[model samples]
Target: MRRGASRDKPGARVVQPPVVYVHGLGSASTVYHAHVAADPRLATRRQLFVDLPGHGISDRPSGFRYTLEDHADALAAALDAAGAVGADIAGHSMGGAVAIVLAARRPDLVSRLVLTEANLDPNPVPKAGSSGIASYNEDAFVRGGSFAAVLERVDPLWAATMRLADPLALHRTAVGLVRGTRPTMRHLLMSLPIDRTYLVGDVDNDLPGRAELAASGVRVEVVPNAGHNIMFDNPQAFINAVAGEAPRVTADAYKS
Candidate 1:
């Protein structure tokens, strides 16, 4: 389910497109949005939280694929249902990949993108979350204790929401993340004409093809004293990135 407050800010209601937060695998959008939404430094624009199907409080359809593309489509539908267009989007982890697909597939709904520690490559290492879950077959993952084990080991911050995810949805989503898209999220990201920024944590700072991304106009910024989960580690910095504060989008004379 989506939750948000309408724009009736101080003075007149200058209704700008809302800022939508999309969560990663086995997590809720509120995990990040809840922490930063009330920050005074944040945008006056309404903040919308999208809890993807099979995760958080949303219903899990047994037949759903829960793939990146599928998640992206769901996001688009959610935004459309909420009457939001050209929104500022901040997506983390698997949600970031989903966001990329959203922007590529439905460019009309996204104007600015801030991707935090997003998964750009396909079939990621089988050590971390997605690949780890993908390693298990659906039956083994859902019926077995693997889901419980994951909840036991994941970061406490994430575990809170991960525990709420449907085992089958989580497993299928993980498998889809590993399979990836035809052009790949990275390829689509580079070609996108919208404002794009990839926020990386200082700890996991080594992002492959950094130079190429910069050349292609994707600003790669770092949040200090944080890990893959920047929102949980340093939310202020994440808020800065989301509110378009830290990097400082300078206003200059038109180049065109």
Candidate 2:
């Protein structure tokens, strides 16, 4: 499912640089197809949908570590393999954290960044730990088989991939996401020397730090009438947000 920009079209003018899209945990790159299709600019621009190690069609080697650093390194390697240098990056949820790390560690590989509801702080949230950093419950996945069972109903291919994914890799990656090492997402985002934007669904009430991010002058866009999964809930809004256009009011009671 790896696709790069088409260079064969004669006289084609590319206004924007290539973009690399990274999906969140438990999801594959296919999650972004709708948003890509909805936006004409993105459809024409060179785009790469990256599947993190053990998540999508990528190989799951025995000794590969799935830490945030490892994921960032893998993403960098993937971009290099595709000969994509200085490409814009967009990531959702856990993928956002990975994109932030990539921008911080390998600035040469990323030009601009668009992060949708990225986990800024991996600390525990309220509500019985049902969301935020606590949401990646490896115990529940292992004991209840919820990951496989739920995905089977929603996405059979993802379910099949989950069955083959290395449990240790999944567990370690989840743990690493919560207990991030030094130069955490916070530090990385604040220090990264590139243009970056933070986007979140307007209905996402559980976001860890909205006020602080706003106060810090980080550009934040709230898609109207959308939740955590902005792409699925409101594909047009997601596309508009990424394209730096004003959110289209598809619903009443638009929240700021």
Candidate 3:
């Protein structure tokens, strides 16, 4: 159940660079190809774009629960399937959150960690009756609705990168909006023990006390002129940053 391609050189594959990509809540891995292409270093590697358990081409079973561990487990399974253990990982949005949890849980499996427009703080619990963070809670907004109705009410929650992409991608991404269970989301939100470099977008103003979260010793960079989906808006800048960090993550990996 993955829906992405892998780019690798033919013949002996000893020099393979493995990078796994986890998409945001409402999108798939197609979002990073252009960014990867912009940087030649990222261009040559086995890039895995995985869909969460119940999203995209992956199975969507009834009563399926979506937790951070579940996403991490699914990612670990994918890496095992692809023989990409100890690979560098990058995640966006919800995927970014998942990446952090995975790295924290299994540091041995992760080399470099890159998170774009992701939250590193413990999941902020919204007020019981608060309409803050838009579609994040309200079942009316998170649940059933026409596309027009959805956009009118919840489009504000979208990242800047999503705004620039084709409307069809948005439509395709909406499939993730149907959260399986309240406890699942809650469990996932509570699993963050932050420590990493998380690149964020200023226009992504939905989160509460974001500055405070940034100050928690995590290297938080606000990508200029971007939104939650920064990769789509400023692909080159994002790619360069990832390319730059790749070496830092791999510098200690001596050849066997």
Each candidate: RMSD: 4.8, 5.7, 8.4
The C-alpha lDDT values of all candidates are 0.81, 0.66, 0.53
Descending-TM-score candidate ranking: 1, 2, 3
Best by lDDT: 1
Cand. 3 TM to true fold: 0.64
Instruction: List, residue by residue over 13-87, the lDDT tens digit for candidate 3.
Output: 457547677777645565454346435666666566666654455654434335555667667767766777766
Better of 2 and 3 by lDDT: 2
TM-score of each: 0.90, 0.77, 0.64
Clashing pairs in 3: 26-173, 160-228, 161-229
- For model 3 the local lDDT of residue 181 reads 28
What TM-score does structure 1 among the candidates reach?
Answer: 0.90
Q: Going through the candidates in order, what is the number of backbone clashes in each? A: 0, 0, 3
Query: How would you encode candidate 2's per-residue C-alpha lDDT over 1-256 as one tens digit per residue?
Result: 2221221111135766677778776656665443454367566767777878876666666466677788888888888877778987878877899888888889899988888888677553543111422354666765666555544654563455445555545565666777665766977787776767777787846655555554444566777788777777778766765665643222222223
